[model samples]
Target: MSNNKIIDLGSSEDPLVLDCGKSIGPIKTAFTTYGELNETKSNAILVCHALTGDQYVASEHPITKKDGWWSLLIGPEKSIDTNKYFVICPNVIGGCMGSTGPNEINPKTGKEYGLDFPVVTIGDMVKAQKLLIDSFGIEKLFSVIGGSMGGMLVLEWLSKFPSYVFSAIPIATTTNHSAQNIALNELARQAIMADPEWKSGNYNIENTKPVKGLSVARMAAHISYLSEQSLHEKFGRNLQNKNKIEFSFDADFQVESYLRHQGFKFVDRFDANSYLYITRAMDYFDLKAENNGSLIEAFKNTNSHILCASFTSDWLYPTSENKVIIKAFNALGLNVSFVEIETDNGHDSFLLDEPEFFQTIKGFLDATYKKL
Candidate 1:
C-alpha cells in the first residue's frame, strides 16, 4: 500500500472482554489507517483523539463536510507525515461517530441504547483499541500520540500496556480529572439533561433532539478549551450584527455569537447521552490504580520513550498537572522528555494549527523512526 492509501477496519461484532472482568456485547470500533504497514508492520502510529474527535484524523469529515480535524498535523511531510509511517485513528468507543455509541441501536430492543449502553472508561477504550492492533498481528506500536482526552488515553496506554508501544506523546492532559474539571462537566450534563426537549435521552426518534440544552452545554464546554486572552483576541466586546448594543438575550457581542454558533453546530452532530457518558468515563479514570495504587510504580518497568507537552495558559489541565506526569517519569528515571509550550492557546492549543507543536511532533517521530 502506498502512503496515501487508507485501510478500514469495520467492527468487532463479538462479545469483548473488559479488564474489569465485565463484558461488552456487540461492540464495533470504527477506525481508519493511512500509509503502508511496511514489511514488518512496524511503522504503525496510533492517533488517539480528544473528546468530540473521531477516527477521521487526516481525511474529510463526513458530518461537517470539512477536512479531517487533524489534517493540520497528519499529511505528507507534516508532523505525523503519513508519507513515512502507517497512521491509525479510531473513533473512540464512546464517541458519536460511526463507532458503537449511545446513539447506536440496541439489537435487543431495536431502539437507540441511549442510557442503556454500558458506561466505558479510558482504560476500556484502550483495551478495545488493543484488540484492533492485535488483529493487525502487530505486537508493538511505533508510537501513540494524542491531546486532552486523547492525551489521557496515551497515559493509560503507557501504564496499562507498557510493552505494546515504542514511544508516546501526550499533550495537554491531566493525570486525573480535577474537581473543577468535574464540576464543569457536571454543569454541561445538567444543561443538556435539563432541557424539556431532552425527553430522557431517547432523542433518536421524533425528528427532534435537545438543541437548547446541548448547545448550552457545548458553549460552556468550549469556553474551557480557550483562555481569557484568547477570547479577548478572537472575540471581545465587539458587537454582533450591529455597531451598537441591542441587549436582550440576543447575541450582542461577538463572543456570544461565537459561543452560540459553537453550541448550535455541536448539537446537530453529537448525542446528548453520549456527551454525558463519555465525560463520566473520563471522570472515573484513575491512572495509578494498577501499580499498587501508586503513579510512580506504574512506570517502573516501562521502556517506552515518552514526550509530554503542556501549554502555558491551559488552566483546564494546567502546567502543574503535567508536572505530576513528569515527576512520575522522573521517579522511574524513564526515557521521557517534557516540553511546556509557551503559548496563549490554552487546552485547545493542542488542537489548533500550531507550527511549533508540529515541529515537536516531527522531531519526536523522527528520533523514534531512526531507531526503527
Candidate 2:
C-alpha cells in the first residue's frame, strides 16, 4: 500500500454535449489511489463519492487537513482493506475540486465559467470516468461502489456497460429523485439565486461574496441530509455562543450556530454554481430510461451481484427506495442482496462512522476477492 495520499492524473479537456443540449467541457479529473493492484489488475475498486464530495475519499483533504471522508472504511487494513484492493476515487465532473467545473477558468471567457458552464448529467460523469479507467489500461472493474449521487453513477455504469463490471454496492441512494427530493433541491437553488450578490450567477472576480442565500441553502439541504434524531442528539436545545440567549436577532441555539458554520465553510470550499449544476443533474436522474423504460430491463443483462443497503432513518433515499431497486433486480432474476442498517445518520450514514456498514462491505468484497 502506498503511504502517499494524493495522485494527480492531470487534466482531460474533452468537449461534450450534456443532457441539457449545451456543449460543455469534460474537464481534467484528479483522482487518488491506494493499495497495490494485483498482476491480473482485477482487484481494482472504484469508490465514487456523493454530491459535494471530491476525490479525497481516503486521504487527508489538501486544504482542510481533516481526515478523508471515508478514512474509516478505506485505510490500509480497514473494511475497504486497501491492503487487499486498489481503490480509485475521482472528483466528479462539474465538481468544485480540482476537477473542471463552473469555477474553472473558461479559456474563451478568460474568466471563471460560473453559470456559463454547460449543464451535465450523471451519465456524462460516468462516461468521463470510463475514459479515466481506460487511461489506466484496466479492461474491467472488480466493483463499482458509491452512495447518494455516487450510487446514481454506479447505476449508470451498470446500465451503460453491463459486460464489464463484476459487482456493485449502492448505499443510501435512489434511481431517480422523487418529487419531494426535487422540491428540496429547487428550494436550495432558489435560496442561492435569491442572493443579491449572486448577480445572476456571474459575479465578478472580486472579494465580494454571496453569503446569506448560500448559508440558507446549505442550512436547508443540511437538514435533509441528517435525521431529526441526529440533530437532537448533537444539539438538543443547547444555547449558542453565550450560555444564555442574547435576547436579540442572532444565533440563539446550538443548531443555528452549527448550521452557520457549515454554510460558511461550504462556500469557502465549494463553488455555488457547481452546487446548482450537480444537484440539478441528480434531480433529473431517471434510471428507468436506461432499461427500456423499466428498471428491470436495465439490470436484465448484468451479471454483477448487487448489495443494496440503506439506512432505516435515511429519508433522503430511504429503505423503500432501495427496495425498489432490489425488486427490479429480482424481477429480472439477477442475484441481489439488500440490507437496511438501522442508524440515525440519515442520508449521510455512508460517510460517517458506522461499524456495521463497514463490516458488511468488507464481507461482501471478501466474498468476491478470490474471483478477482
Candidate 3:
C-alpha cells in the first residue's frame, strides 16, 4: 500500500508567489515520511524526488504496483537508514503525482488547470517545499539528498535556505542546464506538441489524450538517461525473438522494443501536460544566473557541509559539469566533498545498485550524524 500523505499549505491570504509573477493559494503538497522524528526533530532528512518520481520514496507505488523509486538506497538499514533518520519526500508542485500540477482542478474555472497553470520554476518548487517544511515546525533539516533533477532541488535548498540545511548531497546534477540539456528537453516538448491529439493542450477537456506524443517524448528522453556502454551491454543488436532481421519498420531489435516499452508504460502513469511543465522547469534552472553570474556568491552565506557526486559516464550532467559546483564551493572555502563514481550507468547510475555509491553516501551520513 502507498504511504502517501497530503498537506495543504499557502492559503489564500498567504499565497505562494511564483517566478512567473503569478500566485497560487492553498497548494496541495503530497509527501511521505519514514522513521521517527526525534524529540528535538533534529534527525529529519529531506529526500527530493527526480523528474517522473513521486513521494513514494521507499514505499510501494500505488499506480505502478512496483517498489519505490529509491527503494534500494532507503529503508530500515539502508544507506539513508530509516532506523536512525526521519526522511521526508515531497512531490514537486508541477508533478503528475498527488501534488498540485496542470492535471489538478483549478478552483476558479472548475476544470483542470491544463495550459492555464502558471509556468513554475525550480525556485518556485523549492518555495512550495519550504512551506511544507514549515508546517512540520522543522527549524532545521539534518540533511537534504537527491539525484539529477532532484539534485537540482537539493542545490536550490542549499542556495535559497542555506541556514535551514545542515548537510546536502547532490548527485549527478549540475547548477544549471547546459545548452545541450535545453536542446534535448526541447526535442521532447516538440514531440509532444506535434501530436494531433494534443489539441493545443486541451485534450483533457475533449476526453482525449496525447498518449502517442507523450510516449515518443518519453522514448527520446530515456536515451539521454543511459550511456552507450550500458545500452550496448544490455541489448546489443540482438533481434527481438526472430533470428532473421525483419525488413518492416517494426521493433526489430531488442533495444527498440525495450525503449518502446519504457515509453508506453510511462504514459500510463504520467500526464502529458505535467511532462511538458516539469521539463520546462528543469530547462530553466540556472543557479549561477540567479545569483548574478557568481556561483561562489550564491553560496557564500551558510556553512552547510556539502557532498557533490557524479557518475563517470553521465554525459547529461557529466563529471565536468559537477566539478564546476565543487570549484565554487572550494573558492568560498566551504567544507565540501566531491566524488566521481566509476560506472557505465550514465545519469541513471545514482538510481541503480552501485556498491561504491551506496557506501559513499552511508559513510558520509554516518559521519555527519555523529558530528551532531
Candidate 4:
C-alpha cells in the first residue's frame, strides 16, 4: 500500500475505549501516507489535522478537487520534506471524512450513528492513531506536528505515549479550551440544533439536512479564527461588487460576502453532527484536570522534545496559552523550544506561507532527525 487509501481495521475483540468509558469496535480509519518508511522505520512522522482538515494532507481533496490545505508546507521539497521522511495523516474518528464518524452506520440499528455516535476526545483520537501506527509496524515516531486542534492532538499523543514519540510541534493551540472558547463552541452547537430541519440530529433519516443552521454556525466560528487587523486589511468596508449599499442584509460588505461564502461552502462538505461531537471533545480537553490541576504534573516524566509556537494575532489560542505549556515543560526540565511568530494572519498563520514558521519547523526537524 502507498498509504494513500483507506484502511479498515474491521471488528476485533479489542475495541477502542473512550474517555467516556464506552468501548467501540470495528473502527474504519481513513489515512493518507507520503514518502516511504525506511528499513528501520525511524523516519516516520505523524501530521495531525485541524478542525476542517482530512487525511488528504499533501494530496488533492477528493471532494473539493482543490489543492491540499497544507500543500504549501508539506511536500517533496517543502519544510516538512516528504522526500526525506514518511508522513501519515489520519482523519479523526468523529470527523466527517472517511474515518468512522457520526455519518457511519450503527451495526445494531444499521442506520447512521448521527447523535448516537460516542463523544470522542483528544485522547481517543490519539488512541486510534496508535492502532494505525502499530498496523504499519512503526513502534516509534520521529515527530508529531500540527496546529490548532491538530496541535492539541500532538500534545495528547506525547502525553499518553511519551516513549512512542521523539519530538512534537504544537502550534497555535492551548492545553485546554478556555471559557470563552467553550462559549463560542456552544454558540455554534446551538445554531445547528436550533434549526427546525435538524430534527434532533435525525435529518438523515428524514431525507433532509439543516443547511442554513450549519452555515450560520460556520460563519460564527470563522470570525473567531481571524483577527480584527486581518479582517480589516483583507476586506475593510469595501463593497461587494456593488456601486451602493444594498440597504438590506444581503451581504453589502465584501467581508460579509466572504464569510457567507465560507459558510455555504462548509455545509456542503462537513456534517453538522460531526461538528458538534468534535467541538464537544475539544471543550472537554483539559490536560491539567487529568493531573490534579497542575500542568507540571501532566508532564511528570515525559522525554519527548517539544517545539511550541504561537502567533501574535491569534486570539483563539494566544501566546499566553502556549506559555502555560512551555512552563510545564520547563518545570519538568524537559527539552523544549518556543517561538512567538510576529504575524497578522491570526490563528490561521500556521497554515499560511510564513517563511519564519517554515524555517523553524525545517530547522528543528532536520536537526532532530539527525540525532535519531
Reference-based TM-score of each model: 0.94, 0.93, 0.99, 0.98
Candidate 4 residue pairs that clash = 3-33
Q: Give the TM-score of candidate 1.
A: 0.94
Alpha-carbon lDDT, every model: 0.84, 0.83, 0.92, 0.90
- Mark the 10 consecutive residues where model 1 has the least summed lDDT: 1-10
TM-score of candidate 2 against the unseen true structure: 0.93
Off by over 4 Å in 3: none
Clashes of 3: 0
RMSD of candidate 3 to the truth, in angstroms, is 0.8
Q: Rank the candidate models, highest lDDT first.
A: 3, 4, 1, 2
Count of clashing residue pairs in every prediction: 0, 1, 0, 1
Give the range of the ten consecutive residues with the poorest summed lDDT in model 2. Answer: 1-10
Model 1 misplaced stretches (Cα beyond 4 Å) = 1-14, 19-22, 289-293
lDDT of 3 by residue, 274-339 (tens): 889999999999999988999988888858889999999999999999999999999989889999
